[model samples]
Target: MNYILYAVPFFFALIALELLLDRWRGVSTYRFSDTINSLSAGVLSTTVGLLTKAVGLLTYTLAWQQLALVELSAGSLWVWLLAFVLYDFCYYWNHRLGHERNVLWAAHSVHHQSEDYNLSTALRQTSTGFIFGWIFYLPMAVLGVPPVVFLTVAALNLLYQFWVHTRHIPKLGWFEWLFITPSNHRVHHAQNAVYMDRNYGGVFIVWDRLFGTFQEELDAEPVIFGVTTPLASWNPLWANAQFYVALWRDALRAESWWDKLRIWFMRTGWRPADVAAKYPQSKPDLRQFVKFDVPLSLAQKLYAGVQFSLYVLGGTLLLGMGDKLSPAQMLLGVGWMAVGLYALGVWLENRAHAKRLEVARVLLNLPLTWLAVQLSLLSAGPLLWALLLGYSLVSLAALLWTPRTAVGVPA
Candidate 1:
């Protein structure tokens, strides 16, 4: 069962509730550009996962078949409970090393890019995480926990973490002591020195306490969210690639063969001394921090919102039908999604050719859809074709009519 997909509507509903609470309390935790960028990264991650999920599943299944320490049945409630606890134990190390190591951090940093701490920020996830994340769960497989049980527990653990991403929730008196609550998880997301790299537990706060990584939220020192190295752009593609590109450039610049090779695996944000001296990057002053923003016209904002809604709908449909899709069809869908997201990012950034790229995207949809039909992935019926044509025409009209100078600072 795709548990995450079934929870999609509730996620949005909770986000809406958070917004309502923010309004009633006169607090601002969301910005249009930041929230959209966060959600776009999530959509991209989900789309990419459709292609890469087998890597984790197959690896776990193989390990279980070959290395079973004991046979654990899926139907047993005790097995489910034990697996749930055991998965979080593995997740702690996975998440901790993700912060401590450079390569793993590169894959995990996408989730921390947002300056705003809100429900949408929880959705901000990394597309590249599957590359190494499967390694952390092999112990579960080795113990003979059924794949179905492990995946279910992992999904439930993830869903539990979502509600803790909001600023609206304060310290949960007794609950905060045992489980991850909004207060401490906020501390985990913080860039402030004292709070940085503190909490690493997934479901239970007990792991952090036992492992000596726990830090209670300080009332005197407010938490400032985001990574020390600012992402600085709205592009989801760039968000995933920027850290790796920085490391790659540093690797090339390093004079020694050892430094070139070791730099990729060194601590997060660690650059070779020579590279650091020759091409320095300044650390941002937390006291003077400002969130990244770009001006957008009202029409542009409305258009971006409308188009994003369509992408979400398309993503949900893709998720529902993902297993039935061929690799080529999945690739085709991801290609369209990537292009659409990049164009939206351009619009949000108010780039000079934003409108042109958007118009081009609208036009390209026809060829993309025709290609899908040619591949036998999509229906070639007249009604489907008519709908596609109508969609393209309306989108093109909207792009053309959207005002150029309705620009103002985002709220």
Candidate 2:
């Protein structure tokens, strides 16, 4: 039913409300670049999911048709309740393994990369999770839970998670014990040794409690957010690829084929003895920890905000019509959006060539729009052409008017 897509506006509204609360209380929770980068990862995940979601759906449908122990009726209330509870049970192990195993963490680490935890951070999802995530829910299929029930409960579970990402919410008195709340979820996101791998429940906190993985939020030790291996850049693409690249390089350096093969499945952060000795990695001390940031002029911030808004609008449109579009059209739209996002990341980094890259990106849109029309993905009309021309001209004018001194020094 596309519950996630329909919840987009609601998500942004709460983010806006959170921003307002931050101002009123004089406590800062969101950084501009961090929020944008997190949302960019999320947008990329959704757009890419359009192409990759079929993998999980097809596999689950096949498993259900062939291996179901009994046929379960979706109309039965008990079936829905049972599936809702079971899905979270599956999610607990999937999420726990995602943190415990190297291969899985490579995909799940994107969500933990952000140092600033906010509503935007909730949207910071892993695009590569489709690879192994489908296996977690196969138990439901085997139990004869209908596919419709599985998907609905999955969406509801995810939606239930969005509100728990805020810093403004304090610990709920008794609700903290049985359900996943903002307080416990914050502990889940923390990188401190005490909080590193605890609190993995989705909708229910009971699973963590029963399994002895629960950790209460402590008053003495304040939570420090983010991962041990900091994602030090604002680039979304690099954020997704960073851990995988690290593992790949380590595997290449190992002398033994067994170490190379086992490194991926071993406990998270396990490296070959040779690689560990030659090129060791150390965790930063929490006392001196600093969040990643880049200095930017007012113009740069405004430009980034405006351009990101356009991508958000474009991404929303693509998601809404994704099933209706041809494969060629979908590819072109997704590719163009991805390139634009990459350029935006470069701009946030304030690289010396960022202005030129942005100018080139703005110019390319004219032809891309024409191509979209030619492919019949977009309709041909004078108004469409006029709007495109106006946007390009205005964008070019803004780029030309931006001062050379305003190009921020790369962090």
What lDDT does each candidate get? Answer: 0.92, 0.92
Residue 332 alpha-carbon offset, candidate 2, angstroms: 1.3
lDDT of 2 by residue, 267-363 (tens): 9999999999999999999999999888877788888899999999999999998888888898998898889989999988888888899999998
Q: List ranges where model 1 is wrong by over 4 Å.
A: 405-411
| lDDT string, candidate 1, 1-411, tens digits | 999899999999999999999999998999998999999999999999999999999999999999999999999999999999999999999999999999999999999999999999999999999999999999999999999998999999999999999988889999988999999999999999999998999999999999899999999999999999999888899999989998899999999899999998998889899999999999899999998888777788899999999888888888888999999999999999999999898888877778898889998988888898898877755777899899889988998798665443232
**TM-scores for all candidates?**
0.97, 0.98
> Which pairs of residues clash in candidate 2, taking residues 3 or more apart in a chain or in different chains?
none
Residue 151's C-alpha lDDT in candidate 2?
Answer: 90
What is the Cα-based TM-score of model 2?
0.98
